[model samples]
Target: MRNAVLLPNGFVLTTDNSAGIGEKEADLVHVSDEVVAYFATRVALMEQWAAGAHPISIVLHNFSGNKNWDKYVEGIKKLFGEIAQPCPEITGSTESNMETLQSAIAVTLIGKQKTDSAEKYTWYVYGKPCVGQEVMTESDKIADLKKIWESIKSGLVESVWPVGSTGIAEECKRLGLRCELQGWDIVKSAGPATTVLLGIAKNRIEEAKLHFGKYFEEIN
Candidate 1:
């Protein structure tokens, strides 16, 4: 079953989980627990962010040890700091007594949009995800991300739908959107929501370009 739930108070809550994907695969790099934690955080945050919700709290489910615990918390804080987003009240428990073979974590982001207007919008793909790699490399370009968030915060973006593990085609299908993809393939797994499906009006396209630049890919 899907992990996201919508509340009656115009609030949307989404949860995302991460397993020791890297450790299990020889082809993949063995990512640290901190990186895994950040992946979980980003996955949840992307859902909430796309829905025009301001993240108000974080609830973590940690399976790693004390060392991984601190790194996990740091990853959460680091992103908020980088984006200039207020750090939400964070609280969760670690499964210390039990021992597991691989690291795992699940994070849920709670947020509300605080508005009553119900409006439909034109959709665009924002930032292509090269699996999970681009999320890390592109995130390092702080200015680009900041601009995207600034645009979203200012209402230029009507809504957002972060691409999930199922890939862009599935995500678009989930939202009942048709695809006219270009520059990037549409059926690749985003893996923890490293990219988004952006919603805006046709008239606002130029304005969005100023913020998104190469990150924006229109789907007609």
Candidate 2:
């Protein structure tokens, strides 16, 4: 799979790339996957709700890549701007120098927000690194999730002991984190998902969004 992760921070600045964010990584390949997955998932989710007819607003954290990130920013802007009919209110990060993986993660996580809409459910998808993609393991995922929750939540974050593969969802419950299975089937069956957007796309982006569903809902 793509092995991308999207950890959303409810009310923080996108440019807050501070050391206190989370674990920092220097690997470029890993960083790129994470950043791309983050943006792609967000875009896909918004596009679904936009229904190809309404405008979706989003604040993008334009970080990651290397010093040459700008060369590719235009393509991203165009992809998000042109694909959806209404398009997203995409914006770049306020910070300039985001060279590390941690910085990118921190920037994006801090900027995430949740809104209550009686019309439709609002889901915040938190991406997780796939197995074998990163040197990290379920232990690492849990640790990272805990650190993030501690930094954000005022009360004690729920705790879910590792119970095997199926226990993945339970872990989220304990940590108070959201799970993104990358497919609508799992997402839809899992419960009411405002948006089934996830970053860990291995075979296909739309296929991943299916989340155990029989057929994948292709993203436009």
Candidate 3:
């Protein structure tokens, strides 16, 4: 639940990530445009899916350059492929006229709500927090989006909260739950939602544990 707005049709989820990490002479982190876009889109898509909605359209804000547009879109498409879903309609602009020292991108996903049921659930976390270079080095720890989607579709997951720069404790506060995780790990940022908070039915806890394997951890 990064940023979602309720609309007559559905929830509009919007998320953006800007990094000084890119293949630019002035950039701090030397990464390709594709990698930047992939993570940026990942955050937005995670928010949409977590809210039980399927995206219908996408809006991209590319501050990198015009030359990076296709690569950025390819990065977005790659994420969709990972989830076995088609990329939605995309529209956006590039900052061609001005040169920026850092790589920045924003993504907005418009989705139609798929479920409206209310149920009591126990919360848990899947995946470990990773940021910056750690995101690529510790990619294996990132939560599997496809599996999460399946769990949600199967009704094992009642709701989801993607962890962001604010980390798990802040997200827990927003959900009105006391943070039960110990140490600094509970407060460290989960960049680009590498970790997620899942609300599962009490009876389905075991099933979810099996579904998530070593990545699963109870919040309380």
Candidate 4:
């Protein structure tokens, strides 16, 4: 039996399939900003899970750096100080290897049995007309956002609400969709039979409000 913790950005960390990098100094590595955040968040979440957690294998990924990948794993261990070392692995993809890869990833993260009932949830939000310094235009931003959304959604991740770009919302506003204009925040899952996810940030409350107001309306 094994257990896994998934990050908001749709990455799963586990101990299975730690074979992709050939040989390395450490068992884990960082691949991107999202991944770094995953490691940071995992440290906090694991402490909370310890109260009733069972023995589980773990998998950590994103060690694609050309140098010092092993050092990063040590850093993660030092940072989390709670999670046991996991088997490490690198990710690859081919049309033929898709299912096999996913299976490998799942087994590495959640183990052989728990994945049979993986829980899924969505975290949604909206943002303004502005673009980051590196992100040139709204069109470019839309394409990039869609790519990220597509990858996560392809993995059965759901979007709690329609993602509204400042451009998209402006178009929607013209169409009279009553788009709300406020900052955003997050709402976390509460207990059994619940499946809500939250953002990891200081202003998550305001971030959630940008779309759903104080509470979500019940669908009948």
C-alpha local distance difference test of each model: 0.72, 0.31, 0.84, 0.29
Poorest lDDT segment (10 consecutive residues) of candidate 4: 188-197
Per-residue lDDT of candidate 2, residues 1-220 (tens digit): 0111333443322221212122236543342333343334333333222221122344445454354244334433544343333334454553465454443422222223334222321222333223222323332321232222221232121111221222345434543556555542222221111222222223233333343233222221
lDDT of 1: 0.72
**Deviating ranges (above 4 Å) for candidate 1:** 1-3, 21-29, 116-120, 132-145
Where is model 2 poorest over a 10-residue stretch in terms of lDDT? 155-164
Provide the global lDDT of candidate 3 against the true structure.
0.84
* Order of candidate numbers by TM-score, starting with the best: 3, 1, 2, 4
Which lDDT tens digits does candidate 3 get at residues 31-112? 7888888888888877887677878999889898888889889988988898888899899899999988778788888888
Off by over 4 Å in 4: 1-55, 61-67, 82-108, 111-181, 185-220
| Top candidate (TM-score) | 3
Model 2 TM: 0.30
Distance from true location, Cα of 163 in model 4, Å: 12
> Which residue runs of candidate 2 sit more than 4 Å off their true CA positions?
1-25, 28-40, 43-55, 63-86, 97-168, 171-220
Error (Å) of candidate 4 at residue 33 is: 10
- Where in model 3 is the C-alpha error above 4 Å? 182-184
Q: Each model's RMSD to truth, in Å?
A: 3.2, 14.0, 1.6, 14.7
Prediction-by-prediction clash tally: 1, 16, 0, 15
Ranking by lDDT: 3, 1, 2, 4
